[model samples]
Target: MKIPTAAGFVTLMLFCLVHAEICPLSCICKPLGEMKGWLVDCSSKGLKEVPALSVSTRKLYLQNNSMTTVRAGAFDNLRNLEEVNVSDNPWNCDCDILYLKLWLEDFSESSIANVICATPASNERKPLSQLSGNELDSCRKSLPIKCLDFFWRDLALITFAVLVLILTLCALRKHLRKIVLCV
Candidate 1:
């Protein structure tokens, strides 16, 4: 009976060790009971960037870090995420931050309420949830320079087409009048 108990303990220990190894190096991960998911805690790590998270993360804590922005699709793999805290960080609310804001809005609206801007002076301390697309620094420049080039090229083609149509009408006016007189 003792030998069987010891073997069970060893098996459990090995399982736990392997499970813990799935967590990111910069964060702490704990199972959320019965294989539901993990509770990943990366708060107050002074992290400049979001650490890679386990796919099974359900509750993520990233508050009080130095992170300025979360890359686009950073949390896409966490299909089981139920809650996330990204407050108290120096989030630079620029065009790059749009992804985080939009993601939070779709994932959990309440989470974005506490996310505040920490850069670009005008947006400092402003709630990320309150920011409009126009408020972001480079968002207003959404139309690229290449788009302008296309606009100019299209305008020139339209103008040339109109000029050719006018010339054709002028050249045919004498024939039109002759036809009218004969009729």
Candidate 2:
């Protein structure tokens, strides 16, 4: 049997450990289970967006970062996400953030209650779950007006159908009376 050289063995070990350190951009990737949450810290890395994380992340702390925007559907795939701390970032209050805010509102179990904004407008840390209808309206003001127009069109179609049904019933009743008089 041939014996492997020491250099060859070291190279194999390094290859196995490479995946644990290959984080995207300014973030660091580490096995959270291996370090007890101490090695997976992603806060204040000057991240402009939320980075993709492994499925094992149970708690994510993103406070005091330079994140300026969160794209729509950013966290759509994170089904296992239990907690998220996104306070103290320069969040742009705009329509793109509306989807995230709406989703956060629908999912009562989400923990995005402390996300603060620092640009375009400064306000206290706002709870995503508490965003009201007026806030949604303000965000949606710049969106295409076709969405509302379509809603009205649908309503008109339903009303027309109901009116047609009522008119048909009236004509049927009048015809039945004429037949009874002729008999």
In the range 1-183, model 2's lDDT, one tens digit per residue, is: 989899989998897666553344456555557634323357888777788665555566677788766777766765665667677787665545666666665554444566654444433345445555445435556655787899999999999999999999999999999999999
* lDDT string, candidate 1, 124-155, tens digits: 98999999998999998984568789999999
Residue 138 of model 2 has an lDDT of 54
Candidate 1: what lDDT? 0.89
Which candidate gets the maximum TM-score versus the true structure? 1
TM-score of 2: 0.58
Clashing pairs in 1: none
User: Roughly what TM-score does model 1 have, to 2 decimal places?
Assistant: 0.71
- Report the number of backbone clashes for model 2: 0
